[model samples]
Target: MPFIAPWTGENVPSPAAMATRLGRAGYGIGYADEYGIADRVRGALWVRVPVKPGAGGPLLGRIHALRQRQAMTHMLCQGCGQPTVGGRADQRHLFLTASATGRPVAEGEKTVSPPSCAGCALEAVQEGLPSGRRYVAVLVEHAVVWGVAGIVYSPHTLAPVLRDVGNEFTLVAYDDPRLPWTLACREVVALHGCTAVDLRDLSERTPA
Candidate 1:
């Protein structure tokens, strides 16, 4: 199972007493007892989600914030929860993603998906790569912590601002001025020095 995959038992708690606070730039969302040192990341307030992996069956399209952060920060495989790199000689990490354009992944591309180990990569191919999605695999020389996928809130009303048409979530960068008011859901990373690889070729060379 993917390390960052959310289970059915893990769900976002209701915002019973959720509140906003004064930030340096503007008002930001938070709980009354929420600590900036613990909850805020890159000046953005992250949404609080329960951390209960394996409490139920895996939630296919959802991600667990804490596990996703850990996997991205430590270069752990999203497929099997193992380290992507083998040793000092193996510095490059393998990242697999669904490409909407059907083009190979490029350098300086940003993503929230974590890296995959060789074993998991093969398994993913055998399993058909998540239904109808088109996948692109790459060997990333460097994956940099970029920002986050979050909900931007209204400073005046202290309510979540509806996302723009056709957009799922607001992507806020660490340096953005509006980051303080955004409630982060997932950590995002930029893939650098990417070399796209064919899954079939990779599966052929990799042993079972």
Candidate 2:
């Protein structure tokens, strides 16, 4: 894909329009003491013109820009931006990328994308990606926060900064330094106690 999962034709506030705005006003998130988790958790924010992102634009738009945290914890659907809590507690909801085959979801594994609803998962498997990257649905009871995906800026200057050593374009983590301000783009979390399920299995079931 051209756009990320949430940025697909489904989500609102066109990426082209947002990109156009960013181009005109310059693309860079501001430094803040803390970022709102709910904003990034849901794909309800996007960039606006003159770089004056709306209420949730600054952080949420950055998240959307990188296509990172399209979904949040507790089986939040990456496709339709809804809670996919599933019918039973043990059997929640899940949607996996092809790379998730052998890899084990450890206690602190980082997840860029979020879970998908049964309907969206099926839609993806049917005609989501042009390359046909296989995605799997799963049942999970819980998850935990890991970190975030955003640019680190200098609080004094409010300019996006990067690791001094490695790639000049690299960003720092949330717990790095106070000077290197962190603007969270993605709310990463680790999936716990998951049980893989087929899309057909969820056909008769969905999150409430």
Candidate 3:
């Protein structure tokens, strides 16, 4: 059988499952040995079960919906202590790079201008500006540790930062509580360790 996520078009299947399906179908050599279409077909069938309409779709759809919800929940800004519903259209938030001494440097400052609302502007000020040295350091460290872009949160709104930073800096949200703290540790380790953070191990250790 082949695995398929009907709603999202994602594929899923185990090697053993693929082999068994191919063998039962009278296919030779088994999918595991060849790693060809036979294997893909089997995997797709495994996930996209031949069930009634709307059966398998819900599973993938639900996950996507949850992610959307998380994104919306974190869009609010933390600065100005209010939602960014009526923020200026021309204003933007700026994020400055920090130096070795932990002080914010203006050499490669990144700006996120025309924030949709005041909340977003405040979040940029507190999380990206030079005044927020400690917060920026924590966010950068977390990104390095996770082998991903850094995460920023809105203090007043408890929302995550969602925007672009720069080529070297990627902006991400703190949707998961533990993710922020974990990234902070990884950043410190990255300074000394050659290996990147193992996402699988981190997932297993943390709870959703």
Please name the candidate that would achieve the greatest TM-score relative to the true structure: 1
Tens digits of lDDT, candidate 1, 66-89? 888888888998877888666225
The collision pairs in model 1 are none
lDDT of 3 by residue, 136-183 (tens): 211111112112233333434434345465433233223334232211
Candidate 3 lDDT: 0.26
TM-score of each: 0.88, 0.51, 0.19
Error (Å) of candidate 2 at residue 160 is 4.1
lDDT of each: 0.78, 0.45, 0.26
User: Residue-wise lDDT of candidate 2 within 68-154, one digit each (tens)?
Assistant: 343464445655666656434556546455443434344335566677656666666666443534455555566666655555655
Show pairs that collide, candidate 2. none
Residue 189's lDDT in candidate 1: 92
User: Which residue runs of candidate 2 sit more than 4 Å off their true CA positions?
Assistant: 1-75, 89-91, 98-107, 154-180, 198-208
Which portions of model 1 show Cα errors greater than 4 Å?
Answer: 24-26, 204-208
- Tell me the TM-score of model 1: 0.88
Candidate 3: RMSD to truth:
19.6
| Residue 127 in model 3: lDDT | 41
